[model samples]
Target: MRHATYNVNGIRARLPRLLEWLEREKPDIVCLQELKCADESLPIADIEAAGYGAVWHGQKGFNGVAILARGDAPKLRRVGLPGDPDDSHSRYIEAEVGDYVVASLYLPNGNPVGTEKFDYKLKWMERLGSHARVLLAEERPTVLAGDWNVVPEDRDVFSAKATRHDALLQPETRAAYRTIVHQGWTDALRALHPGEDKLYTFWDYTAGCWQRDAGFRIDHLLCSPEAADRLRGAGVDKWARDQEKASDHAPAWVELV
Candidate 1:
């Protein structure tokens, strides 16, 4: 099956592009992040009209996540990563699509270091790592797909030296991701495109980052060992970033057999 993850930035602002993508890609399932809409405000009718059923965890204007399965709505498994009582951002949502469990995540963008947001980001990472372990124990086809907000390595970004201090590319964030991978989760994209460099998933909106190809590969598809074993192919849809009024991040995907 073909599954895709996209950080649409804002569902309302990008609805047209999203519809176009659904028609073009026709993925069996789609995981989305940064919806920026409350549940009541989400365009459920539009999604259904596009031939998919969705389960979403939405926030007022910030983090949000949703899973859309073709034909029928997926069984809602959980919302938000486990392990934090005070954490209430609508940044994580998971569902069961057939035998596989899938989730769309919006990891905290820890900008301007030395702030509460940065600390929150780090704490969240720990929770996510724990949650990933639980999912890995299931030994089923599981996928944690989303805007991970961590640059896995210097090779994944355009200019590692320039972004070394950035929150997404920082040593702390990288270490957290490394720990997750150590638990036997596979970095699907890297596995597919090993040795290739400058593979980015996000570009800054300002400073003409897209034009200069100044970007970071912060979005990802981390697969459990079972799912990774079935991985057929994976890549980022770079063409989507060239669309008019395109989101800063493009769609990334994986195909499993």
Candidate 2:
């Protein structure tokens, strides 16, 4: 099986590119983040016509997530992350497809440190950690895939100095991400290309970041032990980012035997 994760930025605006990508890549399962459209506005017809069945949790004009399976609909598991009743962002969605539990998440971008947004980002990571513990205990084949909004290490970005003060590169943020990975999840891309540098999935739109190859590895696919056992290959679809009017993010994928 092949599974991929992509942060679409805005599904509506990127529908054409998304459709083109689905046709070319033909992944068995896809996790999408940052739909930036409400549930009612999701382009279900186009997605269905592309021969994929999808389940999405959408919010208006901002964060959202979805899972799509080719040939059949994904069995819904959870629509939102647990441990926070007041939290209303549509940033998480999970489903089961052929015994594998897959999740799409859009972690908060906590910019401008020393603010409530940053605090919420940390708290949200804590909740995710708690919930992830439960999932790990199950020992089922699982993949948590999407834009984590985190630059895990200095090597994951083009220049450590450029992003040193950014929230994604903050020590606290990296620590939270590490805590989750320490729970036995395999970072698929890193596992496949251990010593490779400048392998990135996201590039900012401004300052010719993509042209200059100044990018960041924020989109990830984290596989549990059960799924990791079947890991066959992984890669970033960098071509997608080079397309006309493309999203800042490109699809990152993993193949399993």
Candidate 3:
């Protein structure tokens, strides 16, 4: 089976490229983030026409997530993280696709640190860690796929100093992310390419970042032990990011048996 994750940036704005990608890759299961559209506004018709069945959690003009199955409709597992009742960012959605349980998440980008947003990012990661523990206990094959928005190590980013002040590199944020991974989820991409330093998944649209090849590996696929056993290959579809009207992120994928 093939699994992939992509943050579309805005589904409506990137429909053409998205459809093009769907046609090209034909992955078995796909996790999508940053739909940035309300539920009622999701382009279900367009997506369905591309031969995929989808379930999505959407918020108007902001964060959203979805799961797409190539032929079968994903059985909805959950909509939002269980820890926070008042949190309503539409950033998480999980489902069952074939034999695997998959989740698509858009972790908050706590820009301009030292603020309420930064605090929320940390809190959210804690919540994610708590839920991830539960998922691990289930012992089912699963993949936690999404735009994590946290750069795990200095090696994952092109220049730590360039993004040193960003929330993604903050000590607390990295610790929170590590807490979840320490629960035994395998970082699929890193697992396959352990020593690859420049395998980045995202690039900023500004500051000639893409042009200068300045990017980071923020999007990820965390596979449970059950699923990791099936992992055969993993990589970033860098060509997608090089396209016109592309999201800052490219699809990170894994092939499993």
**lDDT (0 to 1) per candidate:** 0.91, 0.94, 0.94
lDDT of 1 at 123: 93
Tens digit per residue, CA lDDT, model 2, 169-240 = 999999999999999999999999999888799999999899999999999999999999999999999999
The deviation in Å at residue 235 for candidate 1 is 0.9
Q: After superposing candidate 3, which stretches have Cα over 4 Å from the reference?
A: none
lDDT of 3 by residue, 67-108 (tens): 999988999999999988999899899999988999999999
How well does candidate 1 match the true structure in TM-score terms? 0.97
* 1 versus 2: better lDDT goes to: 2
Q: Give the candidate order by descending lDDT.
A: 3, 2, 1
Per-structure clash totals for the candidates = 0, 0, 0
For model 2, name the residue pairs that clash: none
lDDT of 3 at 227: 99
Determine which window of 10 residues in candidate 3 has minimal summed lDDT: 170-179
Candidate number that wins on lDDT, 1 or 3: 3
Assess every candidate by TM-score. Answer: 0.97, 0.99, 0.99
